[model samples]
Each structure stands twice: as C-alpha cells, then as structure tokens.
Target chain A: SQQGEEDPQALSIQEGENATMNCSYKTSINNLQWYRQNSGRGLVHLILIRSNEREKHSGRLRVTLDTSKKSSSLLITASRAADTASYFCATGAQGSGNTPLVFGKGTRLSVIA
Target chain B: DAGVTQSPTHLIKTRGQQVTLRCSPKSGHDTVSWYQQALGQGPQFIFQYYEEEERQRGNFPDRFSGHQFPNYSSELNVNALLLGDSALYLCASSIRGIAKNIQYFGAGTRLSVL
Candidate 1:
C-alpha cells in the first residue's frame, strides 16, 4: 500500500513565485524527506526533517513535518522553470529498516518563465 | 568522488525472460536499496541489502530479488519478467550509522518488458 498521498496531482506556477505541496502518511515515521525528479531523470534529494524536527531548510526549499498529524509539506521559494519536475514525499516507517522507501504519488509542478 | 551509479541506462527484455540490473553505491555507503517506479507513479520499495544480507523488504513478491557485494555494489534480478514489470528501476545507497537512511540515488535503469 502507498504510505503517503499528495494533495494536488499537479500545480503550475510562474517563475519567481512560490509553490506548495502537501503529503500525508499512515504509520509512524522516523523522518520525512522530499525529492525532485526531472523528466526521465534520477530523483534528487531535497531535504529531510526528522521526527523530532518540525521544520528544515536547505537552499530554496523548506520542509515542515507534523508528526502528530502524520503529514508534511514542502515549500519551494522563488520557483524557476529549472525547478519544473515531479516532487515526491517519502516517509521512513520506523520498523521497516532497509526498506527502500514508501513514496507518495507525487505532485507534478510546472514552472513557467 | 562518485555518486551512486546504475547501469545499462536502458534495457529491453521479453516477457518470460529474465534480466539483471546493477548498481554501485556512493563512497562510504554500506547499504543499497532498490525501488521500482512506473510512469506517473511514485517509486515502490522492492528490498534493501546491508552487510550482504537481506534486511527489509516491501510488498513485492519473490520474483524480484537482489544481491549486494562485499564492495557494496548491488544487483537486482527479475525472473520470468512480465510486461507489468516494465518500469524504471532505481538504486540508492546510504551509510550504516545513525544517518542510515539518507540515501543517494543513481540515475535509474529503465527496463522495458515486451
């Protein structure tokens, strides 16, 4: 079963604007991570926030985790056409060690210049 | 100096045949994990290898299996391939300490099952 699901199936925004995507998971997680994948490319890790952390920031990306609600959100500031890609949220379930990851059906973001 | 690398870049296989994909993790990473991503879908975990042992697995069946070498390189072997198995197979590697799960991924091997 998919552990998490993204709210918006797709989003479109202009360059310089901001985009937000949300994800919700079912089980207890040790941490939540966000990744971006360009069309026909490998996924690039964005940022990870541990269960004990409520928020984290890396470059232009901000990730917030709400452990109590089993949800998380990713914010990309100053969007660029270069940022156009599929964004995925992943949760590492506490017990499933060595398991690759339970990824959500991502939110496709389109940044138009 | 190198990141995780997965090979062949692309492959074509026939249904009922078998195929093997390989990966070499980033330096200092001891665990290798594999994920399958269908077009327009998020990646699904297949399994993970640590210390040359299968440590955890996803909901996938036995037809999907893997192995990790002492050098931390890995291979994913799919037997009796099905068209449904056609997807991008991804490999990720991570260290084994407290930062056990921050995986760095390879570009992924695109597998086409005819």
Candidate 2:
C-alpha cells in the first residue's frame, strides 16, 4: 500500500507565481524526499528533508517537513512553464536500511504563461 | 557520469507471455531498484537488489522476479503476464550505506500487455 498521499491532485497557476503541494504519510519516516516527473518519463530528484530537519532548500525549491503531523510540503517559487510536470513525495521508513521508497499519487502541476 | 539507463523504451506482449526488461545502473552505484507505475498512479516498488542479492521485495507475486549481475546491472522478468500487468517500468540506482538513500531514476520502459 502507498504510505503517502498528496493533496490537490492537480493545480494550475500563472507563470511567476508560487505553487505549493502537500503530502501526508501514515508511518514514521526517516526522511522525506520530493521528485518530479516530466511527461511520464524518468523522475528527477528534487529535494530531501531528514526526520531531524524541519526545512530544506534547493535553488527555486523549498521543502518543509513536520514529523508530528507526518506531512511535508514542496514550494516552488517563481514557477515557469517549463516547470510543468507531476510532482511526487516518497518516504523512507525509519530503520529500514536502504529499503524501497513508498510513493504517493503525484500532483500534476501546470504553469500557464 | 552516465545516469541509470533502461532498454526497449516501449514493448507490447500478449497475455501468458513472458517478458524481460533490462537496466544499467549509474556509475559507482551498487544498488538497483525497480518500480511499476500504472497510468495515473504513483510508482510501486517491486524490489531492490544489492551485492547481486535480492535484499528486499514488495508485495508482488512470484510472477515478478529479478536478477542483479556482478556488474550491478539488473533485469526484471514477469511470467504469465496478465493484461493488468501493463505499466511503465522504472529503474533506479543508488549507493548503499548512504544516509540519505536518494535514488536516481532512468526513463522507464512502457509495457503494454494485450
């Protein structure tokens, strides 16, 4: 079964605007990572936030994690049309050394010019 | 360094037929993982291979099996394929013992079972 569930199955926004997507998980996670898939192709690793960490940033991407709530959010600033893709959130179980990731149904983001 | 790579970008097979999908891990990576993504759904973990051993597996049945070579490359084989087996197969590579365990993925092979 999928551990994480993403909210706002789909979202649309104008270029230059910010887009936010949230994900909730059922189990305790050692870490939470976000990935982006383009046109159903390969997924690109975006950012990762460890359980001990509350927030992280990579270029235009910012990620926040709340262990108490078992949820995470990805914020993309200054969105561009090129940013259009499906964003997914995956969780690594605590103490599961190098285990497979449990992914949530992705959020399809569309940036219109 | 080259990223993870998979062959036969697209494939078509009939029910009850067996199929094999191949994947080459990224350089310096010692682990390879496979995932099955149905349309409009997230990728489902199939299994993970490390040290040429099946270290972990998902809830898939025996029909889904895999082998990892000494070179760290891997293959996913499904026997007696059913129409429900159609999906995009993804291959991911990562280094073992890494704290983050971040995975690098390859463009998946789209399989269609008729």
- The interface RMSD values of the models, given in order, are 2.2, 1.0
- Residue-by-residue lDDT tens digits, candidate 1, B16-77: 99999999999988999999999999998899899998888888889999999999999999
TM-score of 2: 0.99
Report the CA-based lDDT of candidate 1 relative to the real structure: 0.90
- Cα lDDT of model 2 by residue, A5-94, tens digit: 998999999999999999999998899999999999999999989999999999999999999999999999999999999999999999
> What does the lDDT read for residue A8 in candidate 2?
91
- Which residue ranges in model 1 land beyond 4 Å of their true spot? A95-99
DockQ of each: 0.60, 0.79
Models 1 onward score TM values of 0.96, 0.99
List model 2 lDDT by residue over B35-100, tens digit each.
999999999999999999999999999999999999999999999999999999999999999989
Which residue runs of candidate 2 sit more than 4 Å off their true CA positions? none
